[model samples]
Target chain A: MDEAAVSSLAARLADAGITRLGRSLAVRHVDAGSCGGCEISLAGAVALRAGLTRYGITLVDDPREADVLLITGVVTTTMADAVTRTLGAMAPPRFVVAVGDCAVDGGVFKGAPTVLGGAERIVPVDLLIAGCPPSPGRIIAGLVALLEANAAPVAAARRSSRIEPHA
Target chain B: MNPALDVAIASAAPPGTAVMLDAATWRSLAAGDARLGFVGLFVSGGRVHALFTDGSAPLLLATELIANAYPSIATGFPQAAWFERLAFDQTGATAEGATDRRPAIAQGAAGTDAAWPRFIETAGEGFYQIGAGPVAGRIASPVHRRFSMGRFSMGRFSMGCFSTDDTRILRLEHRLGYAHRGIAGLMRGKSPRVAARFAARIAGDATVAHAVAFARAAEAASGAVAPPRAVALRAIMVAVERMTADLAALAAAVAAAGDARFATLLGQAREQSAVALGEAFGHRLMMDIVVPGGLALDLRGDAVASLLAALDRASLVVRAFAWGRVRRDLGPAAGIAQARARSIRALAASVRADLAVVPEGIIAAALPAGTGTALGAAESARGMVYHWIDLLDGQIRDCVAIDPSARLLPALEAGVVGLDPQAAAVLIACYGLSVGAIDG
Candidate 1:
C-alpha cells in the first residue's frame, strides 16, 4: 500500500474504538530465529507513521503483561523453548500472531536441521501474516482483522446482556 | 609460484589464489604483523584456510591438518579466538593450544543438552553477576550477555553495608549462536544462483550487501562479469540499503535519548524508502532480488522516478534534523546518531548519482560451469562483509560469509567495560550488532 492508504488505515484504526472496548492491546515480540527482516517491518508498524500506538496498541517488554504474542522467524532448536515459555507466560484469551513466512512455515529456512518449521510446530498461531517479511501496512491490516474478529463477539455479548436486563 | 609462496600476494591478483604454507610458516606470518587483520578461518576439503588482509590485499594461508589439529592463531591473534572456536564446532579441526576451547556455534543444537554456555568466573568480594537474554526484551535477535559488576556502597546501614547506586560493569561477555541456521551447511552442493537466497537471508538488514558479495564471489569464481547495468543497479540497492540502516541507527539513538519526535520523523523517512523499494523491486526489504549472475529481475516501469522521489523526501527529513545542531544540543550522546544521519545524506546523494548513470543492457550474465575458489568483499553499512566460496563443477563446495559484526561484537564487549548498565545498552545500540549475521 502507498503512504496515503496507510494514513487512512491509521485513521480508521484510531476510530475503531479499541480502547473504548476497555483494554488497550499489549503486544510482546519474540524473535525465535529471524534474519531480522520481520522485526524491521514490525517496528515500522508501531512507529509514529503507522501509528498503531495511537489506536491503543502498545508493545510491552514483558510477556506476562502482554495480551498478544507476536512471533517472527523460523523456530530454531535453541529458541523453541524460549518461544514456548513466552507464550505460556501470557494470560488466558491471549492471541499468537505469526508475522512472516518463516514463522508461518519456516519460509526459506525450511528443511534446515536447526529449524523446527513455523510457530505452529510449537504453539498455536491465531493469525498468519505471510511475506518474506510482511510490510508494516500488511501487519497493521492483520492486527485490525484480528481485533475486529474478536471485538464483534464481545460487543454482541454486551449489547444482548443490556437488552435482556431492560426487557 | 614457489617464490611467490614465501611472500604475500598483491591485492590485484586473481581472487582465489591461496599461498600454501607449512604450519611453522603460517604461525610465524600470523605472529609477524599486528597490522594484519584476521578476516576469517574456515575448513574446506580437509584443509584449514585462514584469511588475513593487510589493508589493501587479502592473504589466504592454507595448511594441512595433522591429526585434525593446526597451529592456533588465537594465541597470537586474539580476534581469531571466536573464529577458531567456530571452526572447531563446525568441523572437528582443533586450534591446538588455544586458550579458550569452548564450543562457539555447536552449543545449542537440537538433541544436545540445551544448557547455557559456560561463562568466565570473576572471583572477588562485592562483585555480582547479571545475565541478559538469549531472548532480548526488545525486537532483537537472540544473544545472551553475562555482565560481571562491582558495587560501591555510599554508606553502611545498621543491618549491613548496603550498596548504593554506584554499580559499575566490570566485564561483559556475549554468547551468540542462537540464530545459527547452518547457512553454510545449507548452501553446500547448491549452485551459486540457488545459494544466493541463503546468502541474502544471512542478515536481513544487510540483504543487499550479502547478496552483492555472494554474487561477486560467484561471478569471480565463474569468470563472468555482471553487465554494467546490473552493477549499477546493485550499487543503487546497496546505497538505498545503507540509507535505511543509517536511518534505523539514527532513530534508535534518538529514541534512546528521549528525542521521540526526531525518531518518528526518521522512521517516516525510512517507511517511504521501504515503500519505494517495494514498488521498484518486488520485496519491501528487497530480499532475494539479487542473484549470482545479476539481478533476478530488472526495475519495474517508472521505478527510477519513484526511487528518486523517495530519496529526495528522505534527504529533506535528514537535512531538517541537522546533524551539527543535534550533536551540539545532545552532546556526545548524539554523536553516533549524527554520524549516521550524515551517512544517510551521503548515501542519498550517491544513490541519485548512480541512478543517473545506470547503463542500459542485459541485467544478468550466465555463469558457466567452473571449478574455482574466491573471496568477495562488500562494504556494508556496518563495515566490510566478506564471503569466501569454493565451487566445484558449478556447485558450491564450501562457503563462508563473514559479517563485520564478528569483530564489532568483541569490540563492544570490551568497550562496555566500566560503563553503567544504561550507558552500556546505549553503546550496544550504537555498535549496531547483528546477532543473525554473527551467529551465521
Candidate 2:
C-alpha cells in the first residue's frame, strides 16, 4: 500500500501520453509468479476505462493469438521453467509489456534470499507499467499508444556515459 | 432439507466461521439442495461433517449418516462444477449425476480422461469470430484458452490444477487459459521456499489464499505453527493487498462506467500507494516472505510505522474517490447495467432452455444476488479478493474466486452481445475483468 513514488511515476507517464509501444494493441497476459496485481490492472484497462474494444484491440487466450504479451507477477523459481516454455509458445515478433514493479525490478523482492528479480530476467520486455500495481487509466493509455498510428513508445533520452575507475 | 441436519447446523455453526459438517449425512441433506451455498461437508467417518463459515469461527453441522447420495450441485453453482470434477478427479469421490465422470485431473493420470477438459465459446450462430490468447490485458500472461466458434475460431484451455469434488456447490467455469504455468507439476521434489513462490501464482488475486493455503498445508505436515508475529504479518500483509486489489478493480470499474474523471482519481489512489508496498516488501508480490515453519523476517517499528502511514494515505485517496466522485456517476450507470443484465439473463435462460442445456442432476442453482463480496487482506495487492472457498481436510477442496471481476464478466458479456460494440471495453472495465480472472 506504500505507493507514493510508484504513483508519481505512473502519473508522469500518463500525462506524457507515453502509453503506446509501436501501435496501440491488445495484450495477452502471462503469470510467472505474480500475486496477480498486474493482471488486475490489465483487465481494468479493457474492462474499465479505455475499454479494449473501444480501442479496436481485444484479448485472446493463446500466446500465438496475441500481438502483445503483458507479463505480470514475479518469475518464481518453480515457474522459471514454465516461463521459458510459454515464451517459446508465442508467435514471432511478440511484444512483452511488464506490468508491475515485480515484473520490472522484481520491485521489493530484488534481494530476497529466495527471489527472482524483475521479468526481464526471463523475457524481453516492450513496455513497463511500473507500480506495485499501476492505475487502470495509465495502463489504458499505454495500450492505446501502442495502437496509435504513431504507436511506438518514445525511447528514453540517452544519459551521459561515465566510466568508473576500478582500483 | 433434513430437519435434524438443519437444526444441527443452526445449533452448532455460528454465523461466518467455517466448519466441516458430518461428511456422510451431507449426502442426503444435500439430496435436494444440490445448490448449497454456505456449508461444505467432508466425508470421513461415515458421517458427513459440514464446514460452514460463521463470520467468527467454524461451525460443525450435525452429523449425517448415510450410504448413497446424489451429487448434482454441479449444475447449480458454477464453481461447484469444477469441484465435483476435481473431487471425482483427485479423491475418486463422485458427484453422482456429474458430467465427465472419468478422473478430472491425474497426478500421474495423464492421457486419461483425468486430463483437463477444455471447451470454447462456440455452437452459436456467429460471424467468423477469431479471438486471441488467454492472457488478455494491457499486458498479457502466458495463459491459453479453447474457443469453438462456428468453424473458424480455435482456442485452447490453460490454467492450474485443483482437487475438485462435490464437496461444495460453488463452481465457476474458467473459459480461458488451458495451459497455464504448471508450477504445481514442477514442484514435485523442490524445496519449500522455492515452491512458495509457485503457489502464489496459482491464482493471481488469490495469491495470499494460495500462499497461505500452501503454507497452512505445509504446517499441517510439519507440525509447526508460525510465530505470533509472523501470523500477524501474514494477516496484515494479506489484508492490505486485498484492499489494494479491490480499489484497483473499483477504480477500473468507475473508469469503465464512463466516469473517466473518477477513474483518474482512483489511478492516483492506487498507483500512489503501490510504491510503498514495493519499498518495504522485497518483491511487490512478496513471494517468499512466508515459508513452512515461519516468516523470513519480522516487521519491526520503522517498517510497521511506515506501512501504517502508507495505508492511511492510500485509504484517504480511495475514500475521497469513492464518496466524493464515483458514487455520483455510478447511480444512473448501475441502472443501465442492471437492465442490460436482466435482459441478458433472460436471453441466456431462453437459449439454455431451447438447447436443453440444463446440467443433469441439480437444477435451478445460480449465483445469488448480493453474492458480491470484497474480501481484503493487507498483504495482497489487488486488494480484498471476494471468493468462495470449499476446503476439505484443510485442503483447497474447490474454490470459485468471486473476486470483483466475476460479477462483471456476465454483465460485460450481456453488454457486448446486445449493445454498442464500442462500449465493449467499458463493459469489461466496469466488470473488473483482467481476462485472467473471468470465469463463467
Docking category for candidate 1?
medium
List TM-score per model, in order. Answer: 0.90, 0.52
For A1-167, candidate 2 gives per-residue lDDT tens digits of: 22454455445545656543433454566766565566655655554434566777776666666677766666655345555666677776566777777778876456543346678887776567777667566666666654542332333321234344692
Model 2: how far is B77 from its true place, Å? 5.2
User: Candidate 1: which stretches are off by over 4 Å?
Assistant: A1-23, A157-167, B1-6, B10-12, B30-32, B108-116, B123-125, B151-163, B322-335
lDDT of 1: 0.79
RMSD per model, one decimal: 5.4, 15.7
What does candidate 1's lDDT look like per residue over A6-103, in tens digits?
Answer: 45533554565433223367888888889988988987887745467766677888888887889998888878888888889888667788989999
Choose the strongest candidate by DockQ: 1
Candidate 2's DockQ: 0.16
Q: Each model's C-alpha lDDT?
A: 0.79, 0.47
lDDT of 1 by residue, B10-115 (tens): 4336645676776776667545456667777777777888788778767787888889988887766677888888888888899877888777867645457564
Stretches > 4 Å off in candidate 2: A1-167, B1-24, B32-36, B39-56, B59-70, B75-78, B88-94, B99-137, B141-174, B183-194, B220-222, B303-306, B322-440
